[model samples]
Target: MPWGERPRWARWVSVIWIVGFVEGTGAHLLDLISGGLHAYHAWPLPSQVLFHALLVVDLLVAVLVARGLPSGPPLGAAVMVTDLTANYQGNWSGLLHEPLAYVGVTGLLPMTLFGLFVVGTALPLGRAFRGIVRPV
Candidate 1:
């Protein structure tokens, strides 16, 4: 209720982002744990760094959004943008040239969908969080 009226959509957006980040955390954790810290060694060093950073940013955004912090929307948007870039960079060949071939490729579809969701909801979320106060 701290979000006042017109918060229904905000709540839905927050939950969607939380769920996405939680899943991202789990996935990145498994990837690192299974392949060690250098799991993405095949990628360029910067790309590898980006992949590693995903774990932290994903978790951070989730916490920020859950707590009704004002930074959630923008930060979430940035995370998704960066994540989508990384994914696209690695998969652009198949994605651009053979789009249908990537219909069910691992985490690609979900990440893209969630990224689009974050982008579409960013403006509304920004307006909503402009005056949000953490509920006691």
Candidate 2:
């Protein structure tokens, strides 16, 4: 399908995902700016660099996806999964204790859900947006 021919809802989902990606990146950047690099010293330099680099790549993928590229959602989901893996590893223990930490960890649940939703519904949603999946 052509980029301009995508369903409206698919485009909206893509925009939502793009906003989420940008918000996530902005939050991290705010952390870095407010706390300085010392705050992330516990993480290895290479890992830190890789995480930020991936965020940029994710944003780019999101932009492509928002433009109605068929390959965008899967690639975006892949990058999101990588990020979720690293985040889970880093914060898994926090879920065991500390109410504040628990809240913070759970806060990521929505993003995970959104990623899964995008992956699982990509085709159907696309079809629905294109009016192929009509209402009963």
Per-candidate RMSD, Å:
4.2, 4.0
Which tens-of-lDDT digit does each residue in 67-124 have in candidate 2? 6565666666676777777766666677556536445343567667766776675666
Task: Quickly count the clashes in candidate 1.
Answer: 0
- Deviation of model 2 at 134, angstroms: 11
Top-TM-score structure, candidate number: 1
Error of 2 at 132 (Å): 10
Off by over 4 Å in 2: 1-4, 35-39, 44-46, 104-107, 122-136
Per residue, candidate 1 scores C-alpha lDDT tens digits across 13-58 of: 8888889888888888888999988899877788889888888888
lDDT at 89, model 1: 90
Judge candidate 2 at residue 58 and give its lDDT. Answer: 59
